[model samples]
Target: MSNRNIQLAVLDMAGTTVADGGLVLRAFDIAATAAGIETEGPERDRARRYVLDTMGQSKIAVFRALLGDEDRAQQGNLAFEAAYDALIDEVGVTPIPGAAQAIDALRTAGVKVTLTTGFSRGTQDRLLNALGWNDIADLTLAPSQAGRGRPYPDMVLTALLRLRIDAVDQVAVLGDTTSDIGSGLAAGARIVAGTLTGAHDKDQLRAAGATHVLPSVGEFAELILASRI
Candidate 1:
Protein backbone atom coordinates (compact mmCIF):
# COMPACT_ATOMS: atom_id res chain seq x y z
CA MET A 1 0.00 0.00 0.00
CA SER A 2 1.05 3.58 -0.59
CA ASN A 3 2.04 5.67 2.37
CA ARG A 4 0.85 9.23 2.85
CA ASN A 5 4.41 10.31 3.44
CA ILE A 6 6.82 10.48 0.56
CA GLN A 7 9.46 7.79 0.92
CA LEU A 8 11.59 8.41 -2.16
CA ALA A 9 12.69 11.47 -4.06
CA VAL A 10 13.98 10.90 -7.57
CA LEU A 11 15.49 14.16 -8.73
CA ASP A 12 16.73 15.48 -12.05
CA MET A 13 20.32 16.67 -12.38
CA ALA A 14 20.78 19.77 -14.55
CA GLY A 15 18.29 22.42 -13.53
CA THR A 16 16.65 20.70 -10.61
CA THR A 17 19.58 19.81 -8.37
CA VAL A 18 22.55 21.68 -9.72
CA ALA A 19 22.66 25.20 -11.12
CA ASP A 20 24.23 24.85 -14.54
CA GLY A 21 23.90 28.55 -15.37
CA GLY A 22 21.98 27.58 -18.50
CA LEU A 23 25.15 26.12 -19.92
CA VAL A 24 23.26 23.15 -21.26
CA LEU A 25 21.45 25.38 -23.69
CA ARG A 26 24.62 27.16 -24.60
CA ALA A 27 26.28 23.80 -25.18
CA PHE A 28 23.42 22.82 -27.46
CA ASP A 29 23.93 26.02 -29.39
CA ILE A 30 27.59 25.12 -29.76
CA ALA A 31 26.59 21.72 -31.01
CA ALA A 32 24.23 23.32 -33.45
CA THR A 33 26.97 25.54 -34.76
CA ALA A 34 29.38 22.65 -34.97
CA ALA A 35 26.89 20.42 -36.72
CA GLY A 36 26.18 23.08 -39.31
CA ILE A 37 22.60 23.19 -38.11
CA GLU A 38 22.70 26.97 -38.66
CA THR A 39 22.34 30.13 -36.56
CA GLU A 40 20.43 32.67 -38.69
CA GLY A 41 18.31 30.80 -41.19
CA PRO A 42 14.89 29.13 -41.15
CA GLU A 43 16.60 25.84 -40.37
CA ARG A 44 18.35 27.47 -37.45
CA ASP A 45 15.04 28.66 -36.08
CA ARG A 46 13.59 25.17 -36.24
CA ALA A 47 16.67 23.75 -34.58
CA ARG A 48 16.43 26.30 -31.80
CA ARG A 49 12.80 25.48 -31.17
CA TYR A 50 13.58 21.79 -31.09
CA VAL A 51 16.33 22.21 -28.49
CA LEU A 52 14.14 24.34 -26.25
CA ASP A 53 11.16 22.06 -26.71
CA THR A 54 13.13 18.93 -25.95
CA MET A 55 14.60 20.07 -22.67
CA GLY A 56 14.87 17.29 -20.03
CA GLN A 57 15.28 14.70 -22.75
CA SER A 58 18.44 12.78 -23.51
CA LYS A 59 20.99 15.06 -25.17
CA ILE A 60 21.67 12.46 -27.81
CA ALA A 61 17.94 12.12 -28.36
CA VAL A 62 17.55 15.86 -28.72
CA PHE A 63 20.36 15.93 -31.28
CA ARG A 64 18.79 13.00 -33.04
CA ALA A 65 15.59 14.94 -33.35
CA LEU A 66 17.36 18.04 -34.60
CA LEU A 67 19.89 16.36 -36.88
CA GLY A 68 17.45 13.67 -38.03
CA ASP A 69 19.96 10.83 -38.19
CA GLU A 70 21.75 8.60 -35.71
CA ASP A 71 25.29 9.27 -36.93
CA ARG A 72 24.76 13.01 -37.21
CA ALA A 73 23.12 13.06 -33.80
CA GLN A 74 26.14 11.33 -32.24
CA GLN A 75 28.39 13.91 -33.86
CA GLY A 76 26.25 16.68 -32.48
CA ASN A 77 26.15 15.07 -29.04
CA LEU A 78 29.93 14.76 -29.00
CA ALA A 79 30.28 18.46 -29.78
CA PHE A 80 27.67 19.37 -27.21
CA GLU A 81 29.33 17.27 -24.54
CA ALA A 82 32.70 18.83 -25.30
CA ALA A 83 31.24 22.33 -25.06
CA TYR A 84 29.49 21.54 -21.78
CA ASP A 85 32.66 20.04 -20.35
CA ALA A 86 34.69 23.07 -21.35
CA LEU A 87 32.12 25.42 -19.88
CA ILE A 88 31.99 23.58 -16.57
CA ASP A 89 35.75 23.35 -16.43
CA GLU A 90 35.94 27.13 -16.91
CA VAL A 91 33.14 27.87 -14.42
CA GLY A 92 32.53 25.28 -11.76
CA VAL A 93 29.07 23.91 -11.01
CA THR A 94 27.41 24.74 -7.73
CA PRO A 95 24.38 23.23 -6.10
CA ILE A 96 21.30 25.38 -6.03
CA PRO A 97 21.26 27.28 -2.74
CA GLY A 98 20.20 24.79 -0.10
CA ALA A 99 20.03 21.95 -2.61
CA ALA A 100 22.53 19.89 -0.64
CA GLN A 101 20.69 20.82 2.52
CA ALA A 102 17.46 19.60 1.00
CA ILE A 103 19.02 16.31 0.03
CA ASP A 104 20.45 15.91 3.48
CA ALA A 105 17.11 16.76 5.04
CA LEU A 106 15.33 14.21 2.92
CA ARG A 107 17.81 11.48 3.81
CA THR A 108 17.55 12.46 7.45
CA ALA A 109 13.83 11.98 7.17
CA GLY A 110 14.45 8.43 5.84
CA VAL A 111 13.48 9.24 2.29
CA LYS A 112 15.81 7.74 -0.30
CA VAL A 113 17.29 10.39 -2.54
CA THR A 114 18.39 9.33 -5.98
CA LEU A 115 19.49 11.30 -9.03
CA THR A 116 18.48 10.48 -12.57
CA THR A 117 19.62 12.31 -15.67
CA GLY A 118 19.46 12.42 -19.46
CA PHE A 119 23.20 12.70 -19.83
CA SER A 120 25.11 9.56 -20.66
CA ARG A 121 27.11 8.12 -17.78
CA GLY A 122 30.34 9.49 -19.18
CA THR A 123 29.05 13.07 -19.16
CA GLN A 124 27.29 12.47 -15.89
CA ASP A 125 30.47 11.11 -14.34
CA ARG A 126 32.43 14.10 -15.60
CA LEU A 127 30.02 16.55 -14.03
CA LEU A 128 29.72 14.63 -10.77
CA ASN A 129 33.47 14.34 -10.62
CA ALA A 130 33.75 18.09 -11.08
CA LEU A 131 31.23 18.67 -8.30
CA GLY A 132 32.83 15.93 -6.17
CA TRP A 133 29.27 14.69 -5.67
CA ASN A 134 29.84 11.17 -6.93
CA ASP A 135 28.83 9.66 -3.61
CA ILE A 136 26.37 12.32 -2.51
CA ALA A 137 23.15 10.60 -3.50
CA ASP A 138 21.90 7.15 -2.65
CA LEU A 139 22.21 6.27 -6.33
CA THR A 140 22.82 7.97 -9.64
CA LEU A 141 21.45 6.70 -12.91
CA ALA A 142 21.87 7.65 -16.54
CA PRO A 143 19.59 6.85 -19.45
CA SER A 144 22.32 4.75 -20.98
CA GLN A 145 21.81 2.36 -18.08
CA ALA A 146 18.10 2.91 -17.61
CA GLY A 147 17.11 1.94 -21.17
CA ARG A 148 15.25 5.20 -21.76
CA GLY A 149 15.46 8.79 -20.67
CA ARG A 150 13.17 11.55 -19.45
CA PRO A 151 9.44 11.87 -20.14
CA TYR A 152 9.61 8.10 -19.83
CA PRO A 153 9.12 5.95 -16.72
CA ASP A 154 12.16 3.80 -17.23
CA MET A 155 14.65 5.78 -15.20
CA VAL A 156 12.26 6.50 -12.35
CA LEU A 157 11.06 2.93 -12.21
CA THR A 158 14.58 1.66 -12.40
CA ALA A 159 15.53 3.82 -9.46
CA LEU A 160 12.61 2.49 -7.45
CA LEU A 161 13.48 -1.08 -8.22
CA ARG A 162 17.12 -0.59 -7.42
CA LEU A 163 16.30 1.08 -4.12
CA ARG A 164 13.78 -1.68 -3.33
CA ILE A 165 11.11 0.94 -2.86
CA ASP A 166 7.94 -1.00 -3.23
CA ALA A 167 5.20 1.59 -3.40
CA VAL A 168 5.39 3.87 -6.39
CA ASP A 169 2.78 6.08 -4.78
CA GLN A 170 5.22 6.91 -2.00
CA VAL A 171 7.64 8.48 -4.45
CA ALA A 172 8.14 12.15 -5.20
CA VAL A 173 9.47 12.97 -8.61
CA LEU A 174 10.79 16.51 -8.84
CA GLY A 175 12.69 18.35 -11.54
CA ASP A 176 12.86 21.56 -13.57
CA THR A 177 11.34 20.19 -16.74
CA THR A 178 7.99 18.90 -17.94
CA SER A 179 9.67 15.70 -18.99
CA ASP A 180 10.46 15.02 -15.35
CA ILE A 181 6.85 15.46 -14.36
CA GLY A 182 5.74 13.29 -17.25
CA SER A 183 8.07 10.52 -16.16
CA GLY A 184 6.92 10.81 -12.57
CA LEU A 185 3.25 10.75 -13.42
CA ALA A 186 3.76 7.90 -15.82
CA ALA A 187 5.63 6.00 -13.10
CA GLY A 188 2.66 6.61 -10.77
CA ALA A 189 4.58 8.61 -8.19
CA ARG A 190 2.46 10.33 -5.58
CA ILE A 191 4.06 13.75 -5.66
CA VAL A 192 5.23 15.29 -8.92
CA ALA A 193 6.72 18.75 -8.61
CA GLY A 194 8.55 21.17 -10.88
CA THR A 195 10.95 24.03 -10.41
CA LEU A 196 10.78 27.24 -12.43
CA THR A 197 14.54 27.41 -12.70
CA GLY A 198 14.98 25.47 -15.90
CA ALA A 199 13.63 25.35 -19.45
CA HIS A 200 9.95 25.32 -18.42
CA ASP A 201 7.49 27.99 -17.32
CA LYS A 202 4.62 27.73 -14.84
CA ASP A 203 1.88 27.22 -17.37
CA GLN A 204 3.92 24.70 -19.28
CA LEU A 205 4.69 22.69 -16.15
CA ARG A 206 1.13 22.66 -14.91
CA ALA A 207 -0.08 21.62 -18.33
CA ALA A 208 2.47 18.87 -18.29
CA GLY A 209 0.96 17.50 -15.01
CA ALA A 210 2.99 18.94 -12.16
CA THR A 211 1.24 18.77 -8.80
CA HIS A 212 3.16 21.80 -7.59
CA VAL A 213 5.54 24.30 -9.14
CA LEU A 214 8.04 26.06 -6.92
CA PRO A 215 10.64 28.74 -7.53
CA SER A 216 13.63 26.44 -7.12
CA VAL A 217 14.82 23.13 -5.73
CA GLY A 218 16.07 24.96 -2.66
CA GLU A 219 12.52 24.94 -1.33
CA PHE A 220 11.98 21.26 -2.01
CA ALA A 221 12.61 19.97 1.49
CA GLU A 222 10.44 22.66 3.01
CA LEU A 223 7.61 21.77 0.68
CA ILE A 224 7.76 18.12 1.61
CA LEU A 225 8.15 18.89 5.29
CA ALA A 226 5.17 21.19 5.23
CA SER A 227 3.13 18.48 3.58
CA ARG A 228 4.02 16.04 6.35
CA ILE A 229 2.91 18.52 8.97
Candidate 2:
Protein backbone atom coordinates (compact mmCIF):
# COMPACT_ATOMS: atom_id res chain seq x y z
CA MET A 1 0.00 0.00 0.00
CA SER A 2 1.06 3.58 -0.65
CA ASN A 3 1.60 6.14 2.09
CA ARG A 4 -1.23 8.54 2.91
CA ASN A 5 1.08 11.39 3.89
CA ILE A 6 1.15 13.46 0.74
CA GLN A 7 3.84 16.09 0.30
CA LEU A 8 2.76 17.37 -3.09
CA ALA A 9 -0.57 18.16 -4.67
CA VAL A 10 -0.96 18.28 -8.45
CA LEU A 11 -4.18 19.75 -9.74
CA ASP A 12 -5.88 19.64 -13.12
CA MET A 13 -7.49 22.79 -14.46
CA ALA A 14 -10.83 23.20 -16.28
CA GLY A 15 -13.34 20.78 -14.74
CA THR A 16 -11.16 20.05 -11.74
CA THR A 17 -10.19 23.40 -10.26
CA VAL A 18 -12.23 25.78 -12.40
CA ALA A 19 -15.85 26.03 -13.45
CA ASP A 20 -16.41 27.16 -17.02
CA GLY A 21 -19.77 25.57 -17.85
CA GLY A 22 -18.69 23.41 -20.79
CA LEU A 23 -17.06 26.34 -22.54
CA VAL A 24 -14.37 24.13 -24.09
CA LEU A 25 -16.94 21.71 -25.45
CA ARG A 26 -19.03 24.50 -26.89
CA ALA A 27 -15.97 25.92 -28.56
CA PHE A 28 -15.01 22.55 -30.04
CA ASP A 29 -18.52 22.05 -31.39
CA ILE A 30 -18.50 25.40 -33.12
CA ALA A 31 -15.00 24.82 -34.44
CA ALA A 32 -15.73 21.32 -35.64
CA THR A 33 -18.73 22.59 -37.56
CA ALA A 34 -16.67 25.33 -39.11
CA ALA A 35 -14.05 22.75 -40.07
CA GLY A 36 -16.72 20.87 -42.04
CA ILE A 37 -17.15 18.04 -39.54
CA GLU A 38 -20.95 18.33 -39.66
CA THR A 39 -21.99 18.69 -36.05
CA GLU A 40 -25.30 16.85 -35.96
CA GLY A 41 -26.73 13.64 -34.48
CA PRO A 42 -24.06 10.92 -34.38
CA GLU A 43 -21.28 13.21 -35.49
CA ARG A 44 -22.09 15.71 -32.77
CA ASP A 45 -22.27 13.00 -30.14
CA ARG A 46 -19.04 11.52 -31.39
CA ALA A 47 -17.35 14.90 -31.17
CA ARG A 48 -18.59 15.42 -27.64
CA ARG A 49 -17.32 12.00 -26.60
CA TYR A 50 -14.01 12.70 -28.27
CA VAL A 51 -13.68 15.95 -26.36
CA LEU A 52 -14.51 14.31 -23.06
CA ASP A 53 -12.11 11.47 -23.69
CA THR A 54 -9.34 13.88 -24.56
CA MET A 55 -9.97 16.36 -21.74
CA GLY A 56 -6.53 16.30 -20.13
CA GLN A 57 -4.70 15.78 -23.42
CA SER A 58 -2.86 18.48 -25.30
CA LYS A 59 -4.97 20.63 -27.63
CA ILE A 60 -2.90 19.33 -30.52
CA ALA A 61 -3.62 15.77 -29.48
CA VAL A 62 -7.32 16.51 -29.21
CA PHE A 63 -7.34 18.10 -32.65
CA ARG A 64 -5.35 15.27 -34.15
CA ALA A 65 -7.68 12.70 -32.69
CA LEU A 66 -10.81 14.46 -33.87
CA LEU A 67 -9.72 15.79 -37.26
CA GLY A 68 -7.22 13.04 -38.24
CA ASP A 69 -5.51 14.97 -41.06
CA GLU A 70 -2.73 17.39 -40.19
CA ASP A 71 -4.19 20.27 -42.22
CA ARG A 72 -7.69 19.70 -40.91
CA ALA A 73 -6.32 19.32 -37.40
CA GLN A 74 -4.58 22.68 -37.59
CA GLN A 75 -7.68 24.32 -38.98
CA GLY A 76 -9.90 22.73 -36.35
CA ASN A 77 -7.55 23.89 -33.58
CA LEU A 78 -7.57 27.47 -34.88
CA ALA A 79 -11.35 27.43 -35.11
CA PHE A 80 -11.60 26.06 -31.57
CA GLU A 81 -9.38 28.81 -30.26
CA ALA A 82 -11.36 31.51 -32.02
CA ALA A 83 -14.60 30.05 -30.76
CA TYR A 84 -13.27 29.67 -27.21
CA ASP A 85 -11.97 33.24 -27.16
CA ALA A 86 -15.31 34.57 -28.33
CA LEU A 87 -17.12 32.54 -25.69
CA ILE A 88 -14.78 33.83 -22.99
CA ASP A 89 -15.55 37.40 -24.04
CA GLU A 90 -19.24 36.78 -23.46
CA VAL A 91 -18.97 34.55 -20.37
CA GLY A 92 -16.21 34.68 -17.84
CA VAL A 93 -15.03 31.64 -15.87
CA THR A 94 -14.50 31.41 -12.13
CA PRO A 95 -12.67 29.15 -9.75
CA ILE A 96 -14.87 26.41 -8.46
CA PRO A 97 -16.21 26.66 -4.88
CA GLY A 98 -13.39 26.35 -2.34
CA ALA A 99 -10.81 25.90 -5.07
CA ALA A 100 -8.68 28.90 -4.12
CA GLN A 101 -9.17 28.20 -0.47
CA ALA A 102 -8.15 24.58 -0.91
CA ILE A 103 -4.94 25.58 -2.61
CA ASP A 104 -4.22 28.13 0.09
CA ALA A 105 -4.85 25.56 2.80
CA LEU A 106 -2.64 23.02 1.12
CA ARG A 107 0.15 25.55 0.86
CA THR A 108 -0.29 26.51 4.50
CA ALA A 109 0.16 22.85 5.39
CA GLY A 110 3.47 22.82 3.55
CA VAL A 111 2.15 20.81 0.64
CA LYS A 112 3.54 21.87 -2.72
CA VAL A 113 0.84 22.81 -5.20
CA THR A 114 1.20 22.54 -8.95
CA LEU A 115 -1.36 23.12 -11.68
CA THR A 116 -1.37 20.99 -14.82
CA THR A 117 -3.55 21.68 -17.80
CA GLY A 118 -3.84 20.91 -21.50
CA PHE A 119 -4.48 24.52 -22.50
CA SER A 120 -2.03 26.37 -24.67
CA ARG A 121 0.28 28.70 -22.77
CA GLY A 122 -1.21 31.87 -24.24
CA THR A 123 -4.78 30.74 -23.68
CA GLN A 124 -4.09 29.48 -20.15
CA ASP A 125 -2.43 32.74 -19.19
CA ARG A 126 -5.37 34.73 -20.47
CA LEU A 127 -7.82 32.65 -18.46
CA LEU A 128 -5.76 32.87 -15.28
CA ASN A 129 -5.30 36.60 -15.65
CA ALA A 130 -9.00 37.09 -16.16
CA LEU A 131 -9.65 35.11 -12.96
CA GLY A 132 -7.14 37.31 -11.09
CA TRP A 133 -4.91 34.33 -10.34
CA ASN A 134 -1.75 35.78 -11.86
CA ASP A 135 0.30 35.16 -8.71
CA ILE A 136 -1.47 32.60 -6.61
CA ALA A 137 -0.15 29.52 -8.36
CA ASP A 138 3.04 28.02 -6.95
CA LEU A 139 3.75 26.19 -10.19
CA THR A 140 1.80 26.27 -13.45
CA LEU A 141 2.33 24.07 -16.49
CA ALA A 142 0.58 23.82 -19.84
CA PRO A 143 0.80 21.19 -22.57
CA SER A 144 3.27 23.40 -24.42
CA GLN A 145 5.44 23.49 -21.33
CA ALA A 146 5.19 19.76 -20.60
CA GLY A 147 5.87 18.61 -24.16
CA ARG A 148 3.40 15.79 -23.56
CA GLY A 149 -0.18 15.48 -22.36
CA ARG A 150 -2.47 13.64 -20.00
CA PRO A 151 -3.14 9.91 -19.76
CA TYR A 152 0.59 9.76 -20.30
CA PRO A 153 1.81 11.19 -16.94
CA ASP A 154 4.14 13.71 -18.60
CA MET A 155 2.45 16.79 -17.11
CA VAL A 156 2.35 15.34 -13.62
CA LEU A 157 5.96 14.23 -13.84
CA THR A 158 6.91 17.72 -14.99
CA ALA A 159 5.17 19.24 -12.00
CA LEU A 160 6.92 16.81 -9.70
CA LEU A 161 10.28 17.70 -11.21
CA ARG A 162 9.59 21.41 -10.89
CA LEU A 163 8.87 21.02 -7.18
CA ARG A 164 12.10 19.01 -6.83
CA ILE A 165 10.17 16.14 -5.41
CA ASP A 166 11.53 12.62 -5.76
CA ALA A 167 8.83 10.27 -4.61
CA VAL A 168 5.86 9.87 -6.86
CA ASP A 169 4.07 8.06 -4.05
CA GLN A 170 4.18 11.23 -1.99
CA VAL A 171 2.02 13.14 -4.48
CA ALA A 172 -1.73 13.47 -4.74
CA VAL A 173 -3.59 14.50 -7.87
CA LEU A 174 -7.04 16.05 -7.92
CA GLY A 175 -9.17 16.26 -11.01
CA ASP A 176 -12.78 15.84 -12.20
CA THR A 177 -12.25 13.86 -15.36
CA THR A 178 -11.31 10.27 -16.14
CA SER A 179 -8.20 11.38 -17.99
CA ASP A 180 -7.08 13.25 -14.90
CA ILE A 181 -7.53 10.20 -12.72
CA GLY A 182 -5.82 8.00 -15.28
CA SER A 183 -2.86 10.37 -15.42
CA GLY A 184 -2.53 10.40 -11.66
CA LEU A 185 -2.82 6.64 -11.51
CA ALA A 186 -0.24 6.38 -14.23
CA ALA A 187 2.09 8.57 -12.24
CA GLY A 188 1.56 6.41 -9.14
CA ALA A 189 -0.02 9.17 -7.13
CA ARG A 190 -3.09 9.10 -4.99
CA ILE A 191 -6.04 10.39 -7.00
CA VAL A 192 -8.84 12.45 -5.50
CA ALA A 193 -11.87 13.08 -7.62
CA GLY A 194 -13.80 16.34 -7.52
CA THR A 195 -17.41 15.89 -8.53
CA LEU A 196 -18.77 19.36 -7.86
CA THR A 197 -17.02 20.69 -10.95
CA GLY A 198 -19.45 18.61 -13.06
CA ALA A 199 -16.90 16.80 -15.19
CA HIS A 200 -18.28 13.49 -14.03
CA ASP A 201 -20.20 11.97 -11.17
CA LYS A 202 -18.65 10.18 -8.18
CA ASP A 203 -19.22 6.76 -9.71
CA GLN A 204 -17.41 7.70 -12.88
CA LEU A 205 -14.50 9.08 -10.92
CA ARG A 206 -14.25 5.96 -8.79
CA ALA A 207 -14.35 3.86 -11.90
CA ALA A 208 -11.45 5.88 -13.22
CA GLY A 209 -9.40 4.85 -10.12
CA ALA A 210 -9.83 7.83 -7.81
CA THR A 211 -9.08 6.94 -4.22
CA HIS A 212 -11.83 9.24 -3.01
CA VAL A 213 -14.47 11.49 -4.51
CA LEU A 214 -15.35 14.58 -2.54
CA PRO A 215 -18.16 16.98 -3.32
CA SER A 216 -15.85 19.91 -3.81
CA VAL A 217 -12.29 21.02 -3.26
CA GLY A 218 -13.37 22.61 0.02
CA GLU A 219 -14.47 19.27 1.37
CA PHE A 220 -11.23 17.85 0.10
CA ALA A 221 -9.36 20.38 2.24
CA GLU A 222 -11.16 19.21 5.34
CA LEU A 223 -10.37 15.63 4.47
CA ILE A 224 -6.72 16.39 3.91
CA LEU A 225 -6.47 18.12 7.26
CA ALA A 226 -8.12 15.26 9.00
CA SER A 227 -5.75 12.82 7.41
CA ARG A 228 -2.79 14.82 8.58
CA ILE A 229 -4.09 14.93 12.10
lDDT of candidate model 1 versus the reference? 0.86
Residue 166, model 1, lDDT:
77
Candidate 1 residue lDDT tens string, 134-222: 87899999998889898889998998899999789878888988899999999999889999877889999999999999988767777
Candidate 2 lDDT over 1-229, as tens digits, reads 5355777888877877888698998888888887788758887789888887667677878889877899988888888888877787789888987889998999899788888787778778777887788776789888778777887788888888888776887787888778888888888886555554756777778888888888777876666666773
Instruction: Mark the regions of model 2 whose C-alpha exceeds 4 Å error after superposition.
Output: 1-4, 192-194
| lDDT of each candidate versus the true structure | 0.86, 0.79
Give the range where candidate 2 is weakest over 10 consecutive residues by summed lDDT. 190-199
